[model samples]
Target: MAGLPVALAAAGALAYGTAFGLFGEDARTTAGAAAPAWAEEAADGFASVDALGQKGTYGGRGGPVVTVRTLADLEKYATAPGPHVIVVAGAIPVNPVGKEIKVASDKTIIGSGTSGHIVGGGFFLGPGVHNVIIRNLTIRDTYQGVWNDKDHDFDAVQMDGAHHVWIDHNDLRHMADGLIDSRKDTSYVTVSWNRLGNNNKTFGIGWTENTTADLTIHHNWFRETEQRNPSTDNAAHAHLYNNYLQDDPGTAVTSAYGNYARGRTAMVLENSYFQGLTNPVIKDATASLVQRGNVFSGTRGRNESGGTGFDPRRFYPYTLDAAADVPAIVTAGAGPRSALGTPRAAATRTLTVAKDGSGQFTSVQKAVDAVPAGNSSRVVIQVKPGTYREAVKVPSNKPHVTLQGMGASRKDTVLVEGRASGTPRPDGSGTYGTGGSATLAVEADDFQARNLTVANDFDEARNQHLTGHQAVALRTAADRVLLDALIISGDQDTLLLDTAAKDRPGRVRLTNSYVIGNVDFVFGRATAVIDRSVLTLKKRWDGTSAGYVTAPSTPAGRKGFLITRSTVNGDVTAGSFFLGRPWHAGGDATLDPQTTVRDSVLSAAVRPAPWTDMGGFSWKDDRFAEYRNTGPGAGPAGADRPHLTDAQAADQEIADWLGDWTPAAG
Candidate 1:
């Protein structure tokens, strides 16, 4: 209980023994009939809390039990009247004619064991369908569908205008669109203890112009899903608690009204765990949220609300979970699988790359190209001790990839390339842009690099006569990316976080890393956090009197960059380096750049009057601030540097910056 809120801690302890205390007193119901042994266990596991679908009431209460083994058999019983219990056994493959299976009212579909599977089709709950229970099965390889012409809508389970539905303990993945979706007046739904992965869109709640969705999403494991871990549009009331989200590209919970009539969306998010995600909660100007006891570690994103405000207690009367206990609790019991079981061996495929003929591959690019297209599981590429000269790219289709280097230090295994903004392509096209000039470019989600050095060896003195001197060492456009114990070195524009064309902005986390450059080396528009790292500014080669450190082009209403508990050291002359400047792309007046540097040491290499102008844009007009910084280069009072007050610092915490997602590192 390290960071637990006192009120939530007391409540969790009080509800430890009583079964009905967990769900609140309003959810009690009478036991109607005797249930099967397996069904009883499922009820006991989920009934700790009481809600609309508690005690399996959504399923058949008094009807006879019907066991199903084939797709045709299941389809035959789906339309039967009266409360019925339908148990599924063995594999059921759906037809390929774009047919959807429709379910009726008062039905229960339970898988007999772990061997139950539903392939190539999905379940639909719409119109008069009500009181349904689906549990203990695997739904995979559903037809890929489209939504709004641009968004993916492939779904393993879709509910529309339904009530009292409970979907629990199922593994869903590999769909063309979303894994689960509930929209258009769907109410009283509980989704728990399920595993969702390997899909573009994971979950979606509230669609079109309707705003009457009452949902509870708890104890679910979302792994490696790209976006919309449920995009909530004008949802009336949504309670998301105690869920585990890992390696998500976009926002974990999106509450916004895009191109729709403005309405209110009230949300309560508590005791959730986020690891390697971009933003946990992104709300529009019309949305309202109340967050409490949430832990975010090693995550980056904005959690603050930009719209209205409301008290969450008015919507529901429930006990909160302690934030400090969320990681252990979620890790132990969140997914359909239990963490208490025996540890399994690593399932990821490992390949070795050596410059000599000792390994399977000689070049790093060749190893990256060898990855199977649209692979689901993680593939680890281990590079032996050698310097490889190449430009590597991990495409968007190839996700869940890791690049590990066998080196004592980051300097031991290196990837070197030379390409600046002025460098032209082999064809007679324009030169490589700032992003295209990176030595190592990553476009896939869930990408990780450990113990490596990526360098752009552009000759600054020789390229002084060139038009654009920006040479990037790393350009990452994907979300949920991590860089650990790495060295990024170049002269200008060394590291670039490019999300300019993405639907949602990407996020990055850098821990124990070193970045060296002279002008705008660490820059971009993505939401990034640098912890226990170093930013060094080298001397300028053009014989200029001063240089700039950062040039952020952050969009309005978004967090751009944060450097906490780090050190800024440089080899330049005293008072020669400015902290940062602003970049206005296409002279967009709506863009507002933001950056913060707190609790760090600034060397004398930093100028006293930091933050200069760039592209005819004044740095003072942007959002830049410093807090609790000390050293020789700390700018004086009344300088251009704005100081953050204690109250403002409290509001600008890293936890609030990340919302419900807790980062792994501070």
Candidate 2:
């Protein structure tokens, strides 16, 4: 434990050493109690186990039981002798001295509760290791071994040349490399009920020449994870079903073929839900993939590759879950904590806020500050129908918070602030960035707000003297956020779906909402979906030409903005407002922005040439496409407006975009 943090090191020496006995009876006796409810359900729902594939009991059955409370104890039990049911208790933070903590054959290491945590270090199931189960643990901040070094790649859970593994009910985040990776002949693995987020490479199944990997990943929630949401490479047979993927900046499931030896990577992705994703499925010409019963709402790019003619059932024996039922099922059961377990009474802890002191607090910020730190459960802060001029923020640690407005109409309840990008700090420091210049800013995950108005009442003409006049009404850097029936109003940069960074993109789902702005009003790098929403363009007070509706700064190879099944109408003059213009941040030539408007109604305010060049970048070089658009703006004659063909349009459905995330009616 050389790299152990002082806090973890202070937890003292290892407890419960080598007193445990071997075999099923001894293990059961040592375990003391039965498995948790989640564990039982995981076992019953494991696809590999239910399919009757592979070797002996996959999770510490017929083995010895040992409880570990420290990093040293975990290391001892994980590597000592054979077949162990290692119960890890308390927060075990590991700053590993070696490559990683290694796990031997036939082992089940489960956390006692949500308390079990592995920080800075990770577990490695290396060559010849088989029949393992790693469950109910929170693995975070994994060691960043060597940068861009494949051999020394650090992952929270790495299965190499291993088989018969079940990784379930675990929460993994902020890992350096892959969160969960399986490669080199690994077979018969099921990854379920895990919540993976804020990772660069989320999941990787097969490697260059490892063709024998068979992975089943289902009912897991992947939030704001980047590339390799299980990138099946070179002969990997992966079945991805009933998973909830939200705001993935990169492709969720990519069937990649190696250059040296291109094997048939067969992936059956069905009944999955995708929201605010760049590309749901990336099938190369050499790969074999099939997608069915998936739902997509505000997603960009084509869902499937042009390649076809591969049947998934021919390779694996498994029953397909209905895609229509997947959203409800996965949302209810996926992740470490069951969504169903979220008490209805949690909403009862409502803190009411009103401008006239008719509620518990006078302002929204007061109610938010009163919330207990590390609040695990959902807490609703109700705002009565009144305009409160304040800047509000929901910090990162205060998750599962909802800001509800008790307003009959969205315009009735308003949270208004007047901070532009050039607005200096109260302490007389430099101005806030575009992300910081928001009336309402949310950084917490699982945040929700409905039936309210977040308005940046900064007058664009008054702020014309400032250089960066971008004022955002709402800025969200959160995951799994839902904004419904809301009105976000501003001038430039009205609604900023801002993220912490380019690598860590935010996720927000907007439905039946109204966004009104001028120049690049709705912009950011976040993967945002605007479904059945209204995007309106307002005329500048100074009679300046109504600027671009969007100036998306989405990272290269990522989805920026999607307005689907919605309406874009405004009071602007005809041929004045272009749909969007690409914003090249820091003169990055590689930044290719993506924006799509399909199956929507556009007014005459939208120019015939809807996309234009901005910041020395051509909109034509970016990904801006429309399909089946019906309005005066819809045309086949415009050179700037790119239209999708019938075949391409067939792949651009909302069902294909959202995967299986069917948002409830607003």
CA lDDT of each prediction against the hidden true structure: 0.68, 0.69
lDDT of 2 by residue, 235-343 (tens): 4566677787777335433322111112567776777777777666677778777777777756777467433534545644566667667667766655443221110
In candidate 2, stretches whose alpha carbon ends up further than 4 angstroms from where it belongs are 1-348, 637-639, 650-666
TM-score of every model?
Answer: 0.50, 0.50
Residues 288-354, candidate 1, lDDT per residue (tens digit)?
7767666776676665544343454554455556766665665555433211111122368988899
Find the 10 residues in a row with the least total lDDT in model 2. 14-23
**Model 1 TM-score relative to the real fold:** 0.50
**Residue 83 in model 1: lDDT:** 68
TM-score of 2: 0.50
Mark the regions of model 1 whose C-alpha exceeds 4 Å error after superposition: 1-346, 500-503, 542-545, 636-639, 659-666
Q: Which structure among the candidates has the greatest lDDT?
A: 2
